[model samples]
Target: MYRYDEFDETIVRERVKQFRGQVARRLSGELTEEQFKPLRLMNGLYLQLHAYMLRVAIPYGVLSSRQLRRLAHVARRYDKGYGHFTTRQNIQYNWPALVDVPDILDALADVEMHAIQTSGNCIRNVTSDQYAGAAADEVEDPRPWCEIIRQWSTFHPEFSYLPRKFKIAVTASPHDRAAVKVHDIGLILKKGEGGKTGFEVIVGGGLGRTPYIGHTIRDFLPKEHILSYLEAIMRVYNLNGRRDNLFKSRIKILVNTEGPENFRDQVEAEWEKIRDCDIDIPREEIERIKRYFAPPAFEALPGESASFEAARARDAGFDRWVRVNVVAHKVPGYAIANVSLKEPGRPPGDATAEQMEAVADLGERFSFDEIRVTHEQNLCLPHVRKDDLYAVYQALKEAGLAAANVGLASDIIACPGLDYCDLANARSIPIAQALAERFAASGEEEDLGELKINISGCINACGHHHIGHIGILGVDKKGEEFYQITLGGSGAEDASLGEIAGRGLSSSEVVDAVERLARFYKRERREGERFLDAYRRLGHDAFKGAIYADA
Candidate 1:
């Protein structure tokens, strides 16, 4: 919700102007594909299998109704009639023409949005909890800090081209909904001594060919020095991170090779050098950023809504939806409603233009003119009145946006695998669709409580499969698609990379394999254990046996 200041506006407009010229040159044959590769990447454009893809940044996953409408417009006019919301909380247009990209950038600039830093080797979109300011458990809102980092890192010449792409995420809540531990840099906000808020910085956490749960480099860094401290971390990585092998270029590889103790020492030494510099953030600017994220004017009302309670009593389907999709808000008489994009039998994260428009209208009418894109590939209305729940449900239900699977098995996270990406070894969307249908048909989706199934087309880990409770990675065996399963992975506060269970399953066999494993988990779990917990206690061998026992 941070409106662009005049300075921000100028920066975006200038960026658009620069990209427009670059795009014109490429179209006119003045620039070859090789020459334009980095230029296009710098602007978040990619050459996929079938056509060019444009990824637009939704900063910290916050969107105004106006921005949402702009995205809908882009889908309607520029590409196919839909866009894919990615695991990074950004949206992708899979079939945009190269000539139309500048126009898209200009349109985004008009709405105070941009594709800058959504791709390339520089820091990617700085993400945070979708429930940031609204969640009851938050220590403080993290978006202002994210905005500060965005201001500092965007077009920062020093970090323009690193050895590999960088990503940062912040989570104010202890729950770690932002998958902070799996990012290149993860900031966990907490109240330190003397009631001062600070960050517990985690570095070297990322998932790709090599996976890591970032090590804690600093236990407590005061909020005032966040930028300076981040500068130190980047300086250390830039100075010594690998450049010889593309596969070994990420900060996680560097940290693992150097060892966490040595890496920590390097970061601390760099911090000491720059901590007292003029990089200290201004109090007034910090206050200004904070003001944009202050809670919406919520009316004072009683804790319960009579109509909502009555409706729940009357409609079992709606009651089930409320149980799964609705989350508690900090304010009384308000709730956070998560709109599921992972409807059964559809590809995960694909939102049609019409559905996007429907969400935009619902946000404007019922949720204070704002919508949030969840890292789980869903949309959230962060400030819905409890009294309007049924009407909101009806609106969403009619628009094909009302699936009540939030943390359930049906809410899958999948990348556009071989279907879109050139780097993919296999297809991911069909696997997700198959599993969704399998679960729905068996009536097993609702029975499996709080499961996360993440699928990646390749080891690039764009699907974040490494952190799912059940992780599925597509691998190619002599040009055939096969899925390798991993269990016990989680992206929460207790973040861990999933362990590979056993041999790969054919695409035809993967869905039934997943159901078999789920039934196994249900039978083996202790009374209070979730999938990850059950896996930890029961061990991988037991689950592996479950998958192959009946095969």
Candidate 2:
């Protein structure tokens, strides 16, 4: 994790002070709600349907045990006893008082964390593969680059107050776990011709009302030129991106209007002028950042632990959890474990203060004091020893975090919909819960196999429903909740947006519709075919028949 320097500390402290005064003025009626809106948003505060919501950034989804503990403390002391982990790998407290926001920011600053850029139109938290440093297949860790971008974009005078929110994701692995293709800017780190690590830059990818997979703008950009290239892209967007309409304000809209090829040419032209400018990341600086993410010390040991094998043989639940939660690590004896937040019938990506505290303790005890939040909205103990897997599983199970549902049909990704979000027109959580229960009751999940079902309450696609093997989008129809289903979308290396099957189903009919679709896939799939593969092979016609046969 990148530690905050004095400069970083000072800036955050000053910003907190400024926000405190702004809040005071707003409450005092000196500033109207319209005047206070942008300021509050800039600080990661939002006025929800009922109360204010504060989203705190957990940079690159990396947190120290201390920071995790502090977050638990905040959850307990400030608002409700729980917080929601978002798709962007940030945490949101749904009920924070406007008057106490400065205090909340102060508490976050104490742990070297803040809500800065977690919201607003400027660059939000730069995210990456949660398994960046530990993944065996990675060419390089992507966190350092994410950190570099975070630093450059934070309070950037030139790029602040963009037409809309900007997102950037980086991944060093051949597999696109960070969903880079769907970001405003995506960087895939790869080995260049001379075996030098660099970035494959993709620009203008986003999902909202209009979704797009980013177009590759630069096949290869040397690591040192990353910041400079990013600046060039931002400069182009700032100068040329539409400001006339909020719906057409995103860079994706601009890219679509100009065509990707022309947009690429424009970015290249801008890059040529700014390639060696002040933001040109120096080699020394990059090295300095990289050092922070170097792998932790590990003792070499046998790949398979005798004790773990014994536990698996003895405990069926533990065995199931181990199968789904544990991931292969680069280190011989260590494994990365995902602590699932999507337990059956619960809000997805939500952790109570007690569960958060338990995870912090486990991270300290078993994961070398480090915790990671996956883009999939799960907590990770990134460097747990294989021998300790059973013990960690037991602890997690006790805390209700040991659900063996990672990447399964029941492990749904859903946003805080109309229940919490002002922009949402429908409720997403209840639908997710209903579907999860339906799948669990049917015992049909095993048949489904490696299915991803993501739900977003609106077209913002915050829940990443656009890429699910089965995607569900909630919409408002005359004050009633309705859901639209899409099939065959994927967020991996071969990324594709899902196509809607047919008419939107009412909330009551969605789970049954999904079940029907799953049943259809089971009957129609070739041997060993996954849902996505089957969907792609058979096309929407098969699923459409299943969903609308009785409609």
In terms of TM-score, which candidate is strongest?
1
lDDT tens readout by residue for model 2, 455-542: 9999888888889989999888898889999888888888999988888999989888888888888888899999999888887887
- In candidate 1 the C-alpha lDDT for residue 10 amounts to 100
Q: Tell me, by lDDT, which candidate is best.
A: 1
What is the C-alpha lDDT profile of model 1 across 1-551, one tens digit per residue?
79998999999999999999998899899999999999999989999999999999999999999899999999999988999998888999999999889899999999999999888889999999999888999999999999999899999888988989999999999888999988999999999999999999999999999999999989999999999999998988888999999999999998889998999999999889999997868899899999998888899978899999999999988898899999999999999999999999898999999999999999999999989999999999999999998999999999998888999998999999999999999999999998988887777677778999999999998888899889999999998999999988998898889989889999988888899999999998888788888888888899989888788
How much lDDT does each candidate structure score? 0.92, 0.90
Supply candidate 2's per-residue lDDT for 310.
98
RMSD of candidate 2 to true structure, Å:
1.2
- State the TM-score for model 1: 0.99
Runs of candidate 1 with Cα error greater than 4 angstroms are: none
Global lDDT for candidate 1? 0.92
TM-score for each predicted model, relative to the true structure: 0.99, 0.98
Distance from true location, Cα of 278 in model 1, Å: 1.7
Task: Name the runs in model 2 displaced over 4 angstroms.
Answer: none
